[model samples]
Target: MFSLMYETPSSWVQDVEALGTLTLLSDHAHCELKAAATMQALVAKNPTCDSIVRTLPRFAMEELEHFEMVEALLRERGGKLAEQDTSPYADGLHKGSRANRKSLLLDRLILSHIIEARSAERFYLLSEHLQDRELAEFFGSLMPSESAHRIMFLRLAEGLFPAEDVQARTAELRQMEADLISNLPFEARIHSGPKQ
Candidate 1:
């Protein structure tokens, strides 16, 4: 987890429509990497938990593949991974245990789902803005997988917590995610280009 001290300007999104596909790829790769590590921890902590453990192997594998694919894309584009500071994007969503163990897991599960769901939504949005034919095609190809990731996380959350609790957690985490995305000072990325 990184600190939330860094912020990017939202206006940088102007160039995203052009570079948006690459941006989507970058975001997806980062998301999967973070997710895989987090899922590994969750599965290890709850080793005997069949549902959680069973899902992690697949998730981890997919994430690794996604990371490689993104790197390949970057290489093809004649670009390397820039040291983009990522603090604002990660904060707030993850609320650890506050004494009660159950609440902690619930919070973790909710945060994970929010991350995946938001990734799916953002990927879909970026896919719409992509211009390059190959990139556009790639983004389109990823939509179903991204949707599946969200569903898997949501189902995992539901399985681990009560229905009401799952609902409440989803609402809470979604708000947190929204706050992070909406309030961040827009920084220019491959997707978030310069403000027009």
Candidate 2:
């Protein structure tokens, strides 16, 4: 299975729904755009292979479209994309990634995978737990792509590195992510810290 690298806490669900930071939806819109940009940057900086150069533009476009859809969702709900701070959860993960230029590409790819997987998992939670029917439906629709992107990132990393190397790094990162989620204080932003 497709178990998440980390399980979101039950209380996080309860807190999000209760605190009414529906702007989390807005945060998601921003995240999709950021994801798209990340891919675009990777494609631009390292055009060594035609496969990514050709494919990443399409993927980036898809992510931008997702951002649009989420924006629409926010507008329909009488909300605007809230100005929020950067997600500590994601910052922590990125901070933990290898900073040396030699391995940076592989590290970035794996980090992107971890972030996408976490988003996919959170979207599933929103779909299952949110009170609004329309919003829940929308959230459910978004999960497949996030999951797909997670797998895509993994494949890209494997293509760049030995399978065993990728696997080991992925496991290390997954454990790091899980521990981070478990230990951090919760917040209302999308990809915020773990529920506490």
RMSD of each: 5.8, 1.9
lDDT of each: 0.61, 0.80
What digit string (tens of lDDT, one per residue) describes model 1 on residues 1-196? 1111223232232355444445545555665677678888888888988998888788878877877887788778876655545645665344322323457767777666656665555455445654466765665676677678767877887887789988865665665556556654444332222233
Candidates in order, TM-scores: namely 0.78, 0.92
Best by lDDT: 2
> Residue 94: error of model 2 in Å?
1.5
Query: Candidate 2 — which residues are off by over 4 angstroms?
Result: 1-3, 99-102
